[model samples]
Target: MSTATDDGTREDAPPTPTKKQRRAAGIAEEASGGIKLILVKLIGLGIVDALALYAAFVLVMHEQWLVTVLVVAVAALVNWIYFSRRKLPAKYLTPGVIFLVVFQVFVLIYTGYIAFTNYGTGHNGTKEQAVSSLMASSLQRVEDSPTYGVTVVERANELGLLVTDPDGEAFVGTNEQPLEPATGVEYDGDLAVSAEGWKSLQFADVLARTDEVTALAVPYSEDPNDGAIRTPDGQSGYLYVSTLEYDETAGTMTDLETGVVYSDTGVGAFTAEDGEQLLPGWQITVGFDNFVRAVTDVRLAGPLVYVTLWTFAFALLSVATTFFLGLFLAIVFNDMRMRGRKIYRVLMILPYAIPSFLAALVWAGMMNESFGFINQVLFGGASIPWLTDPWLAKVSILIVNLWLGFPYMFLVCMGALQSIPEDIQEAATVDGAKPWAIFRLIKLPLLLVTVAPLLIASFAFNFNNFNTIYMLTDGGPRDSNAPIPVGFTDILITMVYKVAFTGQTRDYGLASAYSIIIFLIVAVISIIAFRRTKSLEELN
Candidate 1:
């Protein structure tokens, strides 16, 4: 290689490696890397293969052929990719991309799909399954039928009741075939105790599975209208008939005793003329009815508006209070003259260091209305409802949230403050600018560029901070005025939770609509806030 002197003369000085020598060096380095890569890939892929095999077996058993096929295919693809000598970029990205698709993309898509369907507590399964469930649940004992001696048995991997009529004729039947005579039998007594094509559940096994035994219903015949045999007590089976009859051709359930025909309402349930609904309704597509109900249903709409307002208030106040308090502390501690600054900073962050939910629980205990530390010890037994009174409970939540949230803001503000050049603040001081004016005009705007996005995130987090609200008050100080499952302190998220779980109104579709609303609110607000944040960046 040669280099030009000041006069631009080039001179050849030293011999460089030939192309073949360079290629050899590259090959040697690549060979070393290849061995290490092979070992890592083999170990990782082996574990993945083992897990895939287990998952495929489970999926196959569940009759989920598509998922089973996909799992096996993914395992094969992974092996092929890692074993190949190409696609370096794909090798690095494969794991993260796969995980993102499965965990995030799939979940969001499923939730969105559920939001559009009536997939709640009652409306959970197919129409056929729901009809079967209704039929099974509505069974009544046949009083005039002959009493049969019975024992619980297994046939074709299904539980059945082995029975014999008053004459001691042996029969083995399941819920699907309530009374089919046993082909092969060895009578132990008048009970006709032993039967072929059946494996008797031992007396000990019956004792162990009391719930299963009680739930067991063996059909008398393939025709459900023929009635079934149910063994309430393990020793004997009773002939039972369903009061409601399902007509497959008509797609209707008829009450046998009452003669009331319940036709499919296409509203996730079977309904009669009087609007009586059958229990355990089927899942159905409802279009935008869930969203429509959220906005138009009398029970939900009124409480939802109040909850949305409170949600906004709670999130805004949380962000504002925490941010200002954190900024104040950050400014105070940022001073070089402050004593034990590091210790103070560490003590300040202790709240953030502990889990937020745990902190919320501790606060809940401290702020309890009756016989609490705040009421008894601090207030001298005043019975001040820190968590019960509507306005006070709201205040209490804000105070608790501030305590839990400010530490995070403090840490972020402290970091952002330190990043600001000291010379800029010093220049303002030399220019005779007052502390407040300088902060408002210069330092604050600069700090925002770093912290504004976090503030927006904090607001979004507080908007749906379910744990804090739940563990603290469980969204209480009940709004008895409204019929819906809501409270004065209830935010939209907490109210959705109540609608889905805590009360009888386990309407998951409605809850999901509420969630989609929340998502839109957060997404819009974030977009606007981030857009405004761009100005802060430009200010810097």
Candidate 2:
């Protein structure tokens, strides 16, 4: 449509969209959005499926049949849920459930399993593997062993020896399989150069893996009494026999030279009459023994008792000191008359803004006995031995923790105090209550209702505060007299870590037992604390 203005200029009007055209446009837009959503879903599911398939393949190769089945089942369930329009809730929940099962549940169950077994350095394999290891460790070369021409070969990533005897007969063997006659073995001089399906290692390859080539023990025959063929140089092999003979029927290992018989007394190792035990013992279940050892072992009991006590004291004192300091500062700054309150509040929380571990490390450096800022500057070069002395180390840890931890409590208390209504305090004051009475009766109870749970969590966190103790003192002023490596400042968690990782012999089962005990202690304490906090809710 066109209209003529007074100035004789023509004006054109825009056309309006019809109802059918609008509806068609809407439908097309919806279709495009649906297609996009489908593409996204497919891409996400494809990635998940790829990862799941890879994990399943690895599990299958390891012969973990049950775990492989579980993984496959989970992947299939995820696909079914995501592809179905009806399972919207399931699609949302599946990822979280899968992660929970994989990380938390699996680790908990495995730790519990290890806690009841002798699963440490020397007891980490099956009985058969232990027997093989024991035999291999005791192997000695025969007096008149015949040397055979040898060549290193690999098949399916397993190394084997291809040897040609003096009679011109070729044979091949690996650690798992006994020597068997080979057909179609290519020979150069008297050495077996290559086989039909095996890849022969060149001189460069053999030199690069000299240790593996030399340690590769090929069994001479299937008989237990027969010795194995071992190579010192890649070109020559010799027969070596084990000094100890294992009798499977009688479940005993006998020393041929000493005539000492070691019997398996169901203790995961072969023990002789003289109380000597053969190592590389198989893992076995010993229900409650680890737990009993923690409490009953003469060497560990004294340190355990003190460490447990110190752990409790440290947690309790950390919570008390941090809370009081934070609460006091929060109260001071929360006053209406306080000038520049915002700046002060921000300064108070600066410690919390930094990472706790980094703060602990900085404090650790500053608290050093001779070279630290605190000793050299603050104390005027006083050698106080803050970390080296036992009592002072504990105090130093408490001081640093308080400094690092108070800022968090300050922020929490500030938030909680702001949440408290001013009307309640005014009402209390009008009722003839003094300022202290008003706070004790009204503000404190209400604040506690919000912060008690946080305090309990703080206690739990400090109970296992490995970073502070580990970074500050490393639980040292080491107890030289203790049989195990323990210190006066060692808490339960740090003690567990030291026992499991720091020593020559890592006792994982005992550490796991300690971990279970810590869990139970924290659980019981949390339960009681949470229940007690319920009484504060009545003030609301």
Candidate 3:
């Protein structure tokens, strides 16, 4: 055997490894990847172990800090696992990945939960916000109350000196009737007031060779016209005023400023007991009352139904017309022989380039019944009822939307058309298929597969196109007998805006619920369309 140099060296350090040890090491290395994996594992373990040890030390050192220590320890453990643990997949988290994943997941779930609850701008505040608001109001102590627009102070001396209201309110004490000294008290000095505070001396301090005595204290009643009154303790009275008063007993508050009486019925919101509703401030929930009113109230439902149907029909027709027009334009523009094709394409996309609101408004003005340019040109002396008539209003919305939407489909179709192999079309042509036959049998079917997603997207967009409906006729011609206050051209989105927010009392809870329901409807419809189109197979 050869002896090794001895700086803590062991000559018999097992001579590498036996066959069994070598096999075991190989197995471990394969299971864990390589040296890099082993190092990562060790580092992660070290971090967790160190944090655990620190947490244990904190727990032992400070028993009362259980929640804080445990929270810190758990956070460290999570970081360690997120950084190095191999149980979870890598795609779930990448390097420098966030360790507080639970927090994000919790927030998403909480938001979804709020959609179901009556939680919104108009509804009552959440429990936590309400509690915090109450605590803030209750704990606030007014040091000196604003009474009779003046500040009256009783000094240590028995002198009764009143200061004029610095806020420019009418004053009680003046130069003619200066503050009087109380019977038992004496005025020690001239009245002096500063921005800091009022200052005066006791009568006892002025008397020489007299034992030091505290100043006289005089109590006076506050002015009756003002909101202040004398207290039973005979020293000071509390000026209890609530800018927003909540009568817990009656669950109502008479707004001192607006003179509106708002009543709360537990869940969230304070509504005026009187028929008149308040606006432009905090919204209160009225439970299912808004929904009931929306459904049963004929004034709202009548117009709502008409507008809803028109909205759906418009969306459907818009998608169909835009698709066919776009396909036709794309096919024409796809020909390589067409001169200045790029220019034609750019000109076609001009409508899409313009803001829809501006375009819609401009279209409205041009189609106006009285002074419209189109009416003047066509009817000459006669004018058209573009906005007044219900059918005409619906036609106007569809026409403008179709003009705006087709360009987008045309652009998408052009790109998708280029992707189709030219050989496929040539083969069809060679097999005795005419141009329309080739397009219908080969091109159209293939194009549908590519453009189906965009079709669904376009439909969804048109369904909620509020700007077009709002600017055109505002859902009007005002059908008085309609279920709700609805217009001939009103869509769901536009109707919801007018009924829920435009009214005197904003109904936020119903609005939130309606939005959530609409979202669900759209999502379901899209899913169905995707399944029917079998676009997922193409994507996969």
Candidate 4:
């Protein structure tokens, strides 16, 4: 390497620039050249962008795909344009902001708009689907249709159906047998007529044979107008339908033999003129029915309301108790000179280390009413009603939740306490401030500045700690007197579980509605907590 001379320039006795300096100066020149090259780069980018947009239009709209593709493609293009723009970082942020505004804000508001209307199970039917499902039709039941009792006689892989009538007439039919009618009858080794040449018929022949026949003494029952006839035993019925007439245009079905018209009313179900509704395919739109049911449905409202209150109470108590105990423990353990402090700290954190659900289950067994240690301690040989009673269950839940939660607070406090300057406490002590005065005036205010946010977060977590509530009590004792099968220990989420899924089948729409409500509540609380923390930060 050449050293610089006193003139402040490197002197290797060279009159020309070195390759390294030329490259260094070239990089500097490149940096100072500004966005002149960037413009050309942007122009190329624009050409590529134009090609992509054209391709997207051709592939999305002009292709066989639905409008959804076009929407997504345009959205992607918008994001690309915003990200590629050589403006400020805030300018790039505009696309994300617009996306969230358009989709999350507007689309979500639109969904809420739809939710207010009749949007539940039956009401999910589109206008076209509803109209099609609600159409009307005519049914006809033809009488005296030729009918026969079919008995499948199978040996090995080959199968044959023996068709018999009430008059002891019999004919052997196979897969090739179309709707061919037999004229001769045979019974008990007596042939009423000699069989002419055997006729080989196709399967379609039998299906197309619509001629009415007399009812026979079969084991099942069927409609006489159609090939459907009932047997004397009443265990089964045989009914043959022609065209299986369903009026897709009218949204109704017609029995071609009975002349019965089943019409769809779009409310309740498909009702015949005689007021008999079909088994299914009926869609109804009852406005606010779900909300009304949720309020009035004894099964849901009673448990839901009580559980909701308990949920709030649990969250509040859990926060208050955990905070105080944790803070106290944190203060005691914060002393640097405390003996075996590391061991004690590790032991204190054991509760958090243990899986909470497993711990809860173990505790539940220990608190069991039949043969638990609590009963032995309290009643010499009997158990306490810890799990059975409502109040006791709530209290037990709070205790268990405290054990699971306080360790976290302690850990946070320990870290925050270290950051509190010793000088502040020393100054307070020297100024005649008492122990409480030092803590209250100096340590606590500083601790709050750090831990207030954590406190709010803990509150939020405890608010939705479904596992704790469920694992502890399972909302028990079968409150049969209550509207639903809710227990005293139940919370809102558990109540929702019971109301939505414990029935004969799951009710998804009602569950979705309840979830939306809970989401709104959590969102509002989070926003409030965030703002409050911000205010505290500002104060600090």
Task: Tell me, by TM-score, which candidate is best.
Answer: 2
- Pairs in clash, predicted candidate 2: none
Please list the residue runs of candidate 1 whose C-alpha ends up more than 4 Å from where it truly belongs after superposition: 1-47, 50-69, 87-92, 143-150, 153-200, 220-223
What is the C-alpha local distance difference test score of candidate 3?
0.60
Model 1 Cα displacement at 67 (Å)? 3.8
- Residues 59-159 of candidate 3 have per-residue lDDT tens digits of 77656476457657665656655455353554245333444544664454543454345544444555334422332232322358653222233333332
lDDT tens digits, residues 75-131, model 1? 998888777766555777899989998999888877788889998888888886787
List TM-score per model, in order. Answer: 0.86, 0.88, 0.57, 0.58
Off by over 4 Å in 3: 1-147, 151-299, 482-485, 535-540
Model 4: per-residue Cα lDDT at residue 322: 84
In candidate 1, which residue pairs clash? 171-182, 175-219, 177-219, 178-219, 178-220, 178-221, 179-220
lDDT (Cα atoms) of all candidates against the true structure: 0.85, 0.89, 0.60, 0.62
lDDT of 2: 0.89
Highest lDDT against the true fold, candidate: 2
lDDT of 4 by residue, 165-184 (tens): 54546554333222233445
Output the worst ten-in-a-row residue range by lDDT, candidate 1.
Answer: 28-37
